[model samples]
Target: MFTDEEFEKYLKELDNPDLSEFEFFTESTGVKVYRRYNKTSGLYDYKTIGGIDVPVDTCFAVYTDLEYRKKWDSYVKELYQFEEDGKKGVYWRVAFPFPLSNRDYVFVRETREFDLNGKHIYVCLGRSAEFKSKKEKSGVVRVNDFLQSMIFTSDGNGTKAFMHYYDNPRGMIPTWLINWAAKSGIPGFLAKMVIACNSYDKYLASKK
Candidate 1:
């Protein structure tokens, strides 16, 4: 569980990451991805910055609405929440491309809102969690190492999004393949998110 101060620290880090050790990876449209090596974990940490031409609240809604996620998140083969405790839960999933084994995560996610420099900001943090009731499923690789944070700030026109993600699949995958996917995958995901938010906004408007 992250305290309010820790969450605030994360937000500060997102706004100003120590780029000295990070290397530029790739960019698509307005999204840019960066990667840094973690000596302790022996894995790479990924960060992405991008702007979506949608309201901040809309973006947050699209992200947290798990039921609505299936429509836009093409990689999610299956997802369901279990053992919910407020914003925390064990979410099942089958992700990654074909030929690779599916992966599942037992994680706790929390969201908080605050004002930063007169702009409304929403922060969502997620990390792996363990429980006695949770167990790994058959034919799926359980992701034991995972941490993700998404910060959305309302700009005058739209929203600016920053994503910090770190995960290890715990398998015999090549580093090059993982790097390739991270570079290409994140921007595409952001693009899809923008489109999905727009679609959802239209859907809401039409109902009025």
Candidate 2:
């Protein structure tokens, strides 16, 4: 279990990651994703940092709204709150392309909001969790090794976002595919998110 203070400390570290160790993977629009190998874990870790042309609140809402996720996140086949408390849940049947088994995650997610340097910052932390209600679904592989965190800071007329993600989907996946997904897939997802945010903002404006 990670405390809020610990999460905060980790988030700060991600902000100033040792760029010397991380190699550039890909960039889409303004988002840049990087990849590095962790010798200790024998797994690849990814970091992404970029600015989106949307308010911090809007960007944060787009990320946390479960119901709205399916509209923008193409890979999310199903998502629902399994536990009553809503903090612990399952991401069911995330779609991977042909020849790769679908994957799912059971995670505990927490969010914190604070102000730093006169800017509002929101941090979301998620880690894999074992829950009694979670069970492997047919044709979908359960992802047990997953840790993800996202930080969004209010920038002038937009939001600056940072993400650190690590996951090991145990299967017979090619190293080239894994590298491609980390490089191309993530930035594409973020680009779609920016479009979603803009559309949502227009929807909100129309209601006014």
Candidate 3:
């Protein structure tokens, strides 16, 4: 069967097709952002927050700690535990828009770039049991898959955050229906993420 991307391309061959997503990556000042949305596309693409930045420890702290996450983002129900990769990561759970739906995700420092001010990248390095809940088996998780990357970079002002979300969850419902719901809901959720990040950025800047 033809993949969604392949079908999209095929349709484009027949006639002009409206792009579901545009400008997969964004750049501003000392920050460059990347993101991807297709279920099977194992890449990162998205927007980055522009303007004054924050410190690496501060930013990472916000992401790794679920309690800290609630101050900034609005989607996490709980963070069960956090463990690092030889002292460079933490594991946690992030809730989705749907009920009893959450993802088992992990975060580990990937690399630090010396250019463009300074850059820090943390990816979803692993997952323990990506289950739907305590009542389910370790079947293919249908909430959020792996391949998500979260990056933080700095500039003369401070540091900017870049979010790279990946995953195409499969479950009882069809992917198309889930994609449709996500298409309708993700923008608002993303807006919340941006707002939370910016608010935290402001709080951090004030501390300096």
Q: Of the candidates shown, which would achieve the greatest lDDT relative to the real structure?
A: 1
Candidate 2 per-residue C-alpha lDDT over 1-208 given as tens digits, one digit per residue, 9 for 90 to 100 = 4697866675575457546778887788888878888775556888888898998899999888876787678889988766744545656558888988899988878888877667678888888888876778788899898988888987688998988889888788866667666776678778888899988866566658
TM-score of 3: 0.47
lDDT of each: 0.81, 0.79, 0.44
Candidate 1, overall lDDT?
0.81
In angstroms, give how far residue 165 of model 1 lies from its true place. 0.5
Once superposed on the true structure, which residue ranges of model 2 sit more than 4 Å away at CA? 11-15, 18-20, 40-42, 84-87, 202-208
TM-score of 2: 0.88
lDDT order, best first, reads: 1, 2, 3
Mark the 10 consecutive residues where model 2 has the least summed lDDT.
Answer: 84-93
Query: In candidate 3, what are the lDDT values of residues 64-134, reduced to their tens digit?
Result: 55555656665554544533333434355455555435654543333323332233333222322332233
Q: For each candidate in turn, give its C-alpha RMSD to the true structure in angstroms.
A: 2.4, 2.6, 10.3
TM-score of every prediction relative to native: 0.89, 0.88, 0.47
Please give the clash total of every predicted structure, in order.
0, 0, 9
